[model samples]
Target: MSLRRFTDELWSDIEPIYAEILEHPFLRGLTDGSLPRTAFRHFVEQDSLYLRDYARALALCGARAPETESVQAFLSDAAGAIAAEQEMLAGFGEELGEEPLSQEVLPTTRAYTSYLLAAAYGGSYAEAVAAVLPCYWIYARVGEQLLAKSSPDPLYARWIAVYGDESFQEIVRRVVALTDELAEQVSPAERQRMRERFTVASRYEWMFWNAAWIGERWPV
Candidate 1:
């Protein structure tokens, strides 16, 4: 099967989870402009935390990449992730008067980043790529959907625009293509492990948003 088909099949397995994410009150509120500012603020702050580690993970993937082109793609993605984080910080400043450093990392933020970083550091190269794919792919898909709805809130609209931008979508497509390419190089067992990593990361994406909606914090 072509890599696109493999990617599509992987997504099919997680389509129900994606559906839940779309129907989530946080996302619904975001599209309708009824989401409380506090929740969005929390999400922005946690995402700021998540992005730094995410960039590092991408860098790790770059380091592990066997080909020059793959290395360049991973590095470019790392740079883009860092840039996105800065943009998120600026958005928070404009919308909530929150400084990136002023926000503490939430538990979910820590857990999700830890999971990704671990995968990047310890998993095979294909698995590392797989671990990171959901973040890129899911946001692109959600952005397109949100753009079609077109939020009335400028903040929400700007957020959607960032993800829906053709440039960012291209990055997502590149990563998906990379994952499919890497999938072909690995053995069947390794491919299964890659899928497992993808699923875990995908689930983490859902949890990250849900955590923001609830304003998750340590019980202790």
Candidate 2:
């Protein structure tokens, strides 16, 4: 079976969670333009922080990949991620007239980034790829869903367009293909580890959106 099929099967186990995410008030508000600016601002800031670390993790994956093609693909993804972060910053700056660098990283953002970095630095290539897949995969899914019922909010619409673009989907397809190829070579035990990592990261994707919805902070 292809890695995409395996991922789809795994996603079926968590499809309910993704459904919940789609129903999240924050996402709903975002799609409808009812989300408070404060909430969206918080999300943009935290995501900017998240993407920096995410790009680093992708770079680490590139360095660890065995094949030249895999290395090129991962490195390209790292660059693309960074570019997306920059675009987000610029878009938010124009919309909110605030600097992204001025915001502090929230606890949820920190936890998510730390987990991804640990996986990238310490886990096998397969594990690292699985760990990062949800961000790409889930965002694309969310984007397409939102785009289908697109909001009149230009800010939200612009955000949706980025993830829903065919280019982004192509990137995800390449990564999924790479993951399946790697899955074929690894031992059963290692494959299990990859699945575990994928599930954890998928949960983190949910938590990230929930945190923004709640405007979560370090309570200490």
Candidate 3:
């Protein structure tokens, strides 16, 4: 389906979740780029683990999925996509004399892992596919705002640079389009249920960052 149609379907699934995200006091700062650099950095560190698991889970999905060709194709294409999302992070990290990629996964990453695992198991491949859309879409959206945030530390600049770059928008479009296609299952009611699931998932999306931002004193 076209991107607009995809957006229509995706909107049903994610709008409620997006609404919850908007209500988050912690993420509210993100609208205008007021989040603390320290918190944001910690969040990025946590994402390293999240991305690793995402790739792994996709790999599992590709392996077990009935149409291994299609599943493998998506996973293979997504392979190394996020890690190379932007080249600025390493430069910024180097400015801080830090390494961008780390070898370990943290507890914060579990939120994303649990999310994908649940969708992959509880829902169909299409649904699991639908559930994964926001990660890419929201990041691209958040990254644009973050890149524009004033006076970012060079380190953070590295991270935000990737999100703001227009090149990643295509990926977002692809994922969103893919989700809408996946949503074309049975009925509007089922689609609405998917939206509800998406909203619940979006809440966790907020908590993942809220936890990192406030370090476990995360507010609901």
Candidate 4:
């Protein structure tokens, strides 16, 4: 599908980051079932934490949105994020072991969610949308790519299926469409801010997976 000019522009800015993400060791391991269980567990744990805050940011965006449609879209997305996290985590109970996975917020996860919340709270609605877009967009894109090669590991394959499915892609398309709608109305400066927010979030997407591969923890 041909993207709107603004959406195209945003993707152009993140092409490099997205490429790096595709080549990340963590994703490579996921494809081959070679990822250490510990690392995957760490990723899941941090992801659970990330989803909680991510929902909050989405809610903020919903609350700040000018249109009822946009408000509904974001609020629905917020609910979906929470539900998806619960479902994903529940399926991993055995893989994560009977012991409760550590709920500690890894440094990268904290930084990423903090940036998202900050944008949702302080920036314009368009900027907030841009801030959260990468999670939806990158995951859908990565999911599709991974699906083409799908993982040998059932767990990894299941996870990939969730994002790669048509339903999830449709959800992402709705957000991208909203972005294009918002972009068409914004001033050049606001559009530039939106671009910046998208770029920053895209970079975080790479850092997030890389952190998981490295078993990131608070240094202090």
Clashing pairs in 2: none
Per-residue lDDT tens digits for candidate 3, residues 1-220, read: 5355745755666665666665665555554456665666566566655766676656655655566555765677458644552333453344434545444455556666787778767776666665665676777876765666623344455556766788787767765765666567547766665665556556667767777677553234
Q: For each candidate, give its TM-score against the true structure.
A: 0.95, 0.94, 0.71, 0.96
Root-mean-square deviation of Cα positions for candidate 1 versus the true structure, in angstroms: 1.7
State the lDDT of candidate 4 residue by residue for 29-100, as single tens digits.
999989888888988888989999999999999999889988898899999989978976788856779998
> What's the CA error at residue 142 for candidate 1, in Å?
0.3
Candidate 1 lDDT over 1-220, as tens digits, reads 5335668767987898899989999999989999998888888888988999999999999999989998998898899889888987875557786344446877898998999999999998899999999999999999999989978998888888888889889888888887878777889999899889989899999999999899888888
Worst 10 residues of 2 by lDDT: 1-10
Each candidate: what lDDT?
0.87, 0.86, 0.61, 0.91
Candidate 1: clashing pairs of residues: none
Residue 135, candidate 1: Cα error in Å is: 0.3
Residue 66 displacement (Å), model 4: 1.7
| lDDT, candidate 3, at 67 | 64
Regions of model 1 farther than 4 Å from truth? 1-4, 98-101
Instruction: Give the lDDT of residue 86 in candidate 1.
Output: 91
Q: Could you tell me the C-alpha RMSD of candidate 2 in Å? A: 1.9
* lDDT top scorer: 4
Off by over 4 Å in 4: 1-4
Instruction: Mark the regions of model 3 whose C-alpha exceeds 4 Å error after superposition.
Output: 1-6, 12-37, 61-73, 81-108, 148-151, 187-190, 217-220
What lDDT does model 3 reach? 0.61
Residue 19 lDDT, candidate 4, scale 0-100:
95
- Model 4 scores a TM of 0.96
lDDT (Cα, 0-100) at 106 in candidate 1: 78
